[model samples]
Target: MSAENEIVPPPGAAHRFAVVGMGATGVGVFVALVRSLVAGGRAAGAEVHIFETKERLGAGVAYSTPHDCHLLNMRASTMSVHPDDPDHFVRWLSAHPGAGPAVESEYVPRRLFAEYLQEFFEEALVEARQCGIKVRTHKSVVSDCREDARGVHLIAGLDHFVFGRVFLCLGDLPSTAYLEFTKLPTYVHSMWQGAGLETIAPDATVGILGTSLTAVDALLQLRGAGHRGAITCFSRRRALPKVQGPSVRYTLRHVTEENLGRLTDGFTRQLEFAEVAELFRRELEDGLGLAIDWKRVLARPAETFTHTLARDVERAERGQTLWYSILDATSEIVPLVWRTMSAGARASFMTEHLSIWSMFRHCMPLDNARRLLGMATDGAFTVASELSAVSYDEEDAVFQVSAGGTTHRVRWLVNATGTGFALDCSDSSLIQNMLMRGDITPHPLGGIDVDFDSLRVLRRDGSHSARAHYIGPLTRGVHFYTNSFETNLANAHSAVAAALN
Candidate 1:
């Protein structure tokens, strides 16, 4: 471990690239790198490295979690590493003789997807090494990052990994942000806390603060664990994810490879919903000339950003006058609507547009949510809104909440308010460290303030990170549709292009 070989600052640091958080975004970037360098014949000459805190590379928090029963909102066929290779995943599934026949396109187990990604990266890494690309896997978290003329230097496990360019593939924060109910000990904080449902004793009354997919997962876990307790879920407006069912049109498979190259540009530039539907109808009839399943189209809006925006605009336009009512009534479509709003727009909309959301946004599932209602009607689980905690008497295991100024007392409360964001997070070592070192800055609650076009990191001081770029939720403010495979793939395509240049 001499000074020279002790992994000191290497030469040509500016030409190197270090990526943090090896989730889907990381996988996307890894594939993007191979595509770029291999295409340029510099694959072996390029230095690309990733620092991942997750137990394995390419399976950050999202996929790293060991929840198999929890199905992906998406089907396996759609989650491909290469945007151009539309059937990459489907083909992979088929090629894996052990995986069995082409069964129904149901939500695949999250673990299977994780393993698929793991295998994909391992193979890609081998290919990368064959081309002379240097791929380093550090099992540590990046506590901080600094930039100098040499480029971006990241502190991972006391070593400085310098890179000419950096891409952050970090996903959402740990669910513990909702520990507000636990400000007193009577509540359990961080639903991901060890089979979250197990915390509540059988027959004990507990409250959940969120109404999204996470909450549903927790509910399912609780029921599986045989907890006959009174469970209460609190959300300003809670919505259940739409179920998988029949569709009117097929999935939008372009936005990539062909870029619908076979189609016309007048085809998909919709900033609104009707325009999108019309484009799809026309494209299928005039170009591909077939009916696209409406169900599939709605379910897989993953690609069609223009269509998504148009849909949200349409949703908003219809409910403008009935704001709160619309949000309350259409509660089932939050995920879709949420996807459509830009990060900046989301922040602004979430704040001032509470009325719209309250009326239309949060929805309980008509069928699946019946499980929740059963719990409620049976007097075991109660769902409430506008809950406020009065105080906690930790010793006595009593927590109080006030809604509409009326305080309700409970033996315990669970803070399930949902994920913490940049604005709300101050103690995360990764984020705090990044902020302190001026390596990255949190954008206004809307997102990470990424240059929508370049995907470069916009510093807290209002400047782009000389070498760093952020992907995933960090870019939510700018891209709005980050964290999805489609968005990640798009980001990889765009940012890697910049890196190569």
Candidate 2:
């Protein structure tokens, strides 16, 4: 059997699984599925295939950075890809005992994480060998998933292929949020892709449109690249993230790490956002025990509470108000909160709060990840509440942001505004064609719609079938908890169960 296309068939004696998007989540899914099959005493009767667009597995956009400076924000103590094996990465690090303390104890470079993932991938493949289960890796974009009375057709260009089961673990799409700011060469975008870096010179005055984790990575990458510019980042409020506690001694504390669970409550959010301004303020100021670490709150949602709270309010009253509350609480715990919202909720929340959320949550880290509150001595980057918009001065080689009714123009600009899943504007050709051909439809609220049980995409008439399955950020509308390590693992396990059952 060849390495890339090793499929053993003794008159359909083995089961098959093909997972798409070989990023961290996809790899986790593949490993979990193969691991299950390998352990089930039916390993020899299974065939698993992996497909990726970026040449290799493990490192997608997140870990694919070709730089040493870009390190994960989460410390070495908490960055394992496997939830069950918390120290899998720590153990991996122990292999090189003499690698040094700072590199060992602190957050190591993303490249190190990439290496760990690759190592795990190889280990899983080796283990699956005895069961005749092989991961056939195809280096091509999966264009669409077409289904008839039979199975599913994974279309990639003119080539037609088939997979018994498919999982879409597509990661972050292009940061085309501010497409309104066209015609400016200095408007650089994409912290991960590095697509807009070439348009800027050493001293090009720049303005980053949003302030999220992506913004933080971009700023660090720029400084590492020796970018000598007056880089003034603007959002709805210029709000930088609150630094992780314990780094510097604080006179007072808000939310501690222990119960990072409350951030997921829409009930709490609704009760908080009932009115404006102060109502929101008191909720966040409550306490650490009452609230949880922002990310943990995000990863583990208070869904029952949210559902109960949502039941009381009419659909119309729920959206912006509930969204504002979630956005306010989500400032410190963006990614995890992001993990919990349904694709529709994410689209709505992002649509309504993109400018506001970016202002408060997406902030540039400088001089040792200093919290913005520490440096706003004279209000250089202080908290301000306001509305903002984007307008272009094409000939001037600039893009302007009209925040609080003042048009601030910058030399270089790129639409770092983020992605639009309007079906037509997606970066994934597969997604675009899927929407175009009715293979998938947007959830009523927003994002790709799916059935509540199987996590499979729902058609236009809202019917559920087992032929198609989706995972990752796209299914935010259905699962609400897509793409986290847990979500990825759960989706894969569920997908495998659904397929095999």
Candidate 3:
């Protein structure tokens, strides 16, 4: 490409900024961009473009549910978009009566959180307008992105545009691919897509893939819709997420940054996996005021998975799991710990500990756990561990799932396995194009590789791309906590600061 063609700026445009995928992550980036542009006195007639194919911009797939049965996994108190205010969303909820009660400790519906995000986005836009920034929304898919000396060029449909910088705040990747079940009428690739769980027959024997939060959402939706068929959830570990408990405040001890420094010998070298694990063990013990029974938790020879879940829920009900706050507090320094870990240690964490970490960290609400236990006790739901050899019979139009020497057939299959992060395995055209052109490289753990702090997309040649910045779950391999709104918002702030600098 010629320098003239690539280096040219948009006509009459000063400081053009583009944010792709206007989901929760994108909205957070938008807030950071507006604030940075306005604070830097660059918002006068600055052009800001947001691209999304969804009807709504800020809600994203996670929060776009209209069902009242779906609830936010976290409490209302901790979901603020702005870190400085800390209670902005909670305060907004207090002011708006239509959003149900504004109790900070309550687990509000995801739709209510969506409303809060939309309102927050609009308020930010209004502030942008006050500073003479033009905010434009493009309801279309971004096909390709290529960078040059001048800026980044984004292709949306037949239209092409260049921006000073682009924030690829792309939300969760597409659902996991099921090549064997492709073209089968009974197989649903994604439960979050069009028609959702409603497409399943009311009396059909339904098989749900994975026992994560997504599976729980599907289960609740099906129950709410009056589905009475047998529902079996497949899990490799047969472990359901623990229940969310009442708000607990605790002091940090062994997980402190100072302790991390001491462990690393004043940050002279990379951290080992064992050292980090030991620190966490101490943290839990100190925070809980009781030593955790590692042997019982790991072995669990006598208790069922559902029984373990019930025990945790019971602890939550009795306000005894104050140790949960330790994990909550770890959020502040997770990036530091994640980045300093050796590559091999990081990979070990991904392979051996990630699932258990998720089981504890991404727990469901207590009410949801109760409902799940109730359904399990009623014999309407069954969870199987180590499900292997999932095959579909085209003639019978049934999916045969095998686990632990038992085979079960279901007429309907739902791939609620949640989003996959492997960039090479991604079916998205834009991501594939970027990888093909070396605009981004795949991380060893998962997702696209990027810089440790700023999140600038790193090319195959080990150079960072000035044109593109990624701030999403894809960065989890390096950042370790990109799944939360708090982490994404923090990432956006850092990216914007780096870009401005």
Candidate 4:
């Protein structure tokens, strides 16, 4: 290592803390750490180190979009940085003139949300500083992290910092399935990275590899940039996410504490997928205040997917849907529900129902859904499933995508399948180094193996790490709703509380 790569702590530092990624998750973890330490009167002489390769501290890749067309999938009223303060974000937005439109029930631009996050972190940082906490921000990536008797050591760029406790808030990993197409000029492996889309011609035919929310982002960006090219989105299941409906509070009967206790006998045994399905079915019927056919709701014909979208859009417009509210309630308790499942059941759910569950549970805003409907009606966009293959023509500098027994030629292809969490294929050197040494193992479902309650990493030898914890999406194997902002913040609070206690 070079001379500049080495870092030394000041003499007699009392306690040291490190947050490995300063995105939204990292920011949440950092704030929780500050709050925990301060509440316990342990903030003095505490050193908190934040590591992030990017210049921005709080936005992360998801909310850092510069494009105005990209909007938050959920309404602003429901998004709050702190779990205790449900309306904190809404209050903040109301005070800011640049928050764009009304705070509640509006799909504001994601860039503005990034601004909110930045300002939120800064406000918390001010309080942390008042408590005499030493905050160090590093604009470098952590290459490796290891723990021993002394403490946890993080190696970033050339510097090494030792911490009493470390929180791994590493954000989304890149899409690993597109590794073979990384070198191709026509292939856009990640739409979140830089201004790659700006290079494509206005009229260039583009194909997106998935029909999830990420694909919607790319489509909106293309439209915003005045691209009139033919856009085709392909996936193994060509189902798009359901549209968000008017906000309503729902009473969750089957998914409640009492029902959960009856199922688990107060956390005694593992759960089956069938049991969970029953709970979901009951909750849906109860919330809708009607008994409905389960088959029609769960399984729609591929040709009728658009029709379903239109029907849901009408429900949303009429404010007659309580499904989104039920989704929100389920999201709040997902960790508990996920942990109840046996490993085999979790794996089965991942293989069989995750795609469909995600499509319905994680829907887009109604306005965006309307735009999609209009696009489909105008023949400006088409979706296909069973995406078998994609190949590039070097001579012609275009891509040939084969999906649903048809081939389409396009000048650009986007891998919008979203992030994958396989540890072996991770891009982070920190994760790779830890996985190589068996410091952390991959969960059978996906993401890092961890104790669901404490958020402590489970070692390759089947022991939990004392000085290290994970508090982000990587814990999704055990916490299936890790993608939601509310879930991530809640997990961060739990991790910080456990570490402090």
Candidate 5:
């Protein structure tokens, strides 16, 4: 075996595992590990340690929001915590009618999802206990982690613990953009932070950065709170996310494992960008039974933002968005395709196609889109492209935002640009400390480096830590679709299997 893949004996108990950060990813890893231990006949006297600082164990930042307007992007049918069982979450929601309506194909409020995760986690804990497994929870942030000859050492504030294996599921990081105005009360660096949009006056003009889903959330929250001020979304492209349509299941033909195997000659070669694009083209064309206008699809629409949104809504209502269904069907194989691509191809996609790709892939719910359309029709919201500069005037207590060759002044500027992937700019001291100690290395494209198969974190010297595994959105560099719950859950299972093996 390669030196990096070598496994060492546990210093103490063999079944002791530690999961740092009890978000969705961390919860997945913990549950998978518990089930694996029980299935492998190792549950007797087995112990699992969970470390998190959040008030809610499994909610994390993504679903912790109490706003009903902040809806999940994906449908409930696909948001199962169990990768193998797609109906797990839906079943849970059915059992608890007070949580929210259980529409399997509909997008529910994120807070409802949070309740689902917490309840699922509670059930897992009960099952673990019944199986003679000891589950422990720590309400402290993990400040640092280091592996030595003994075991994996985790320092959480004043306390310290050791475990046979450690899974890092730190979730998404806050955006590091617009740091210069962080001290300004009017400039909100993160929309998820404490009392985010509530501080903005009802009549305050707002300028939100980026036209991603996060920006959509900000706008919806503002509207939900009865904000009557005009809001302008600023971004380089200013293209809003596509609206999700009816859930249609599609079987892939071109972007399948068999086709990929044939193209790579049994996994001997890296795939070129053009080759992958052609496969996608074939898949979309086959699904639609018509030729796709690549230029028209990729290019920014000439119509106004409201018109485009209305048209997308109409198309979605008519179920004419078969292409989106086709794209969604390829989610399972996306990581495999990404891993097989040459580095140049991956970098090229990140540089040129990531924005547009995200705009389509991470879409808003039809409900939210319709509400945004209403706001647009009321002349309270607009999107501007070609965003250049933004500066704050202390005397005037307003922000000057330059975009589309016009400068607009707003009372508040929000950095709704979404998650930041740069580790150097991470807000977590644990990640910062790990980087300083060479416990982890950053990926060239983004996030930290990890073994694509085992999810073991690779160190500065290119050696994989035997006891440390990272599975979260920050692993996007290794798995392109890590943002999705399904991908993260699958990764959690893989990491547990590797750790137990």
Candidate 6:
């Protein structure tokens, strides 16, 4: 190894730590690791290496958007980096008045959250330095990682560095589902990649794939830019996300650890899908004080998209959606529920209820919902379900999208289908290389397999790595609730604790 790559510890330091990726997840790991080390009197002369190619460290892809139109789905009260302190983000917002308005119950722009994260990270760096911890940042992508006797090795470009422990906090991976159209000038595969939406002509028709939150973001951006084109959001189920209502504090009774433990016989038995469904049913009915009309909630409504949007907005405005509050309360125990489930149960949920579940669970803020309703009423765009197929016309330079038994031609096609979880199909060389070397294995449901409690990566041979821990959205299959910042932060603390132990 070269002199720079040598694992020589500083004069008083005995261990070196490396965090791959400087997104929100990475920032969480770094902060948690620093705090843990300082508390344990191990921070003196310790080295922390952060690897990322992005100009901004903590913004990541989700919060990196500069547009004010893209708002956070969660309210400000719950968007804190410290899991124990629910008001941490709100306090930060209070201190930084120039960032944006601070309303604990309101959904703020994502850029503001990005600023909070960057500031939080900077503060952590200051603390780390004061405690005699050496911080190093490598502005390069980690292409591969391998763990052996010496330590965990991270290969970034032509350079290699080994650390006593490595935390892989790489954020969401872009969807490769529509890679065929990637080369086409009219098709934008990843919406977050710079200035893709700005290239669209003001009057040209646009077709957006997937009606998830990302699709909502694209539509809002197009509208904010004063695009006069008719935009159509295409999806297989044709269902838009539910709108957020007034925040309500709910204490979980059904989906608690005690209940789960009893159901799983102290977690020795795997839970069936039906068992988990019953728990949710009971919880929802208990919260609403009435039996739920499951058929109505699950079935595709006969009402048009505009009608559904309006009704949901009205319900949200009235704060009559107690089910949402109840569901939100269950976020803490979702991963435990997922872990107790049998493999067959997990597979069944993924194939059967994933779409509808996502629509209800991952909701949009009321502000965006009202904006979408107005746009729909004004005939700016329409959401179409039953997306059958799509084809590109080379000579015409337009996309032909077939949905709901009608073919619509659009000059621009945007894929807002959200992040891809398939490891083998990932665009990241680091993930692909790790998979190839048997350092990690794909979870059957989604993401990479990991030890649930420790957050350590599980290899193809069914052994957990001692020095490597994986966190972020890629742990979705294992955690089932890894998308939220709070969950990722908690997981980071868990991973760092395990690493230190």
Compare the candidates by lDDT and give the number of the best one.
6
Worst lDDT 10-window in candidate 6: 6-15
Between prediction 1 and prediction 3, the one with superior lDDT is 3
Model 6 global lDDT (CA atoms, 0 to 1): 0.90
* Total backbone clashes of candidate 6, pairs 3 or more residues apart or in separate chains: 0
Where in model 6 is the C-alpha error above 4 Å? 1-14, 100-105
Task: For each candidate, give its TM-score against the true structure.
Answer: 0.73, 0.72, 0.96, 0.95, 0.96, 0.96
In angstroms, give how far residue 447 of model 6 lies from its true place.
1.6
Off by over 4 Å in 2: 1-14, 96-99, 102-105, 180-189, 247-368, 371-387, 418-421, 481-483
Per-residue CA lDDT of model 4 for 290-318, tens digit only, reads 99887876774645556766887898899
lDDT of 5 at 444: 93
lDDT of every predicted structure (CA atoms): 0.59, 0.57, 0.83, 0.84, 0.89, 0.90
Order the candidates by lDDT, highest first: 6, 5, 4, 3, 1, 2
What RMSD does model 5 have?
3.1
Distance from true position, residue 84, model 4, in Å? 2.2
| Candidate 1 lDDT score relative to the true structure | 0.59
For model 2, what is the error of residue 17's alpha carbon versus the real structure, in angstroms, after optimal superposition? 2.2
How many clashing pairs per prediction, in order? Answer: 41, 24, 0, 1, 0, 0
- For candidate 2, the per-residue lDDT at 182 reads 38
**Residue-wise C-alpha lDDT for candidate 5, range 1-501, written one tens digit per residue:** 788777765555456889998888888888898889989999988889999888898888799898988888998888988666888777777777765453643788888888888877888899899999999889988999999866888999899887889999998788867778888988888888876889999999999999999999999999989999889999897499998888888999899999999999998999999999999999999989999889998888899999999999999889888888999999999999998899999999999889988988888888899999999999989999999999888899999999989999999999988778889888889999999999999999889899988899999998999999999998888899987988998999999999988
Cα lDDT tens digits, model 3, 282-394, are: 88887767888998765523677667767887988987657566787788788889877899899998888887888878888888888887877777778887888798887
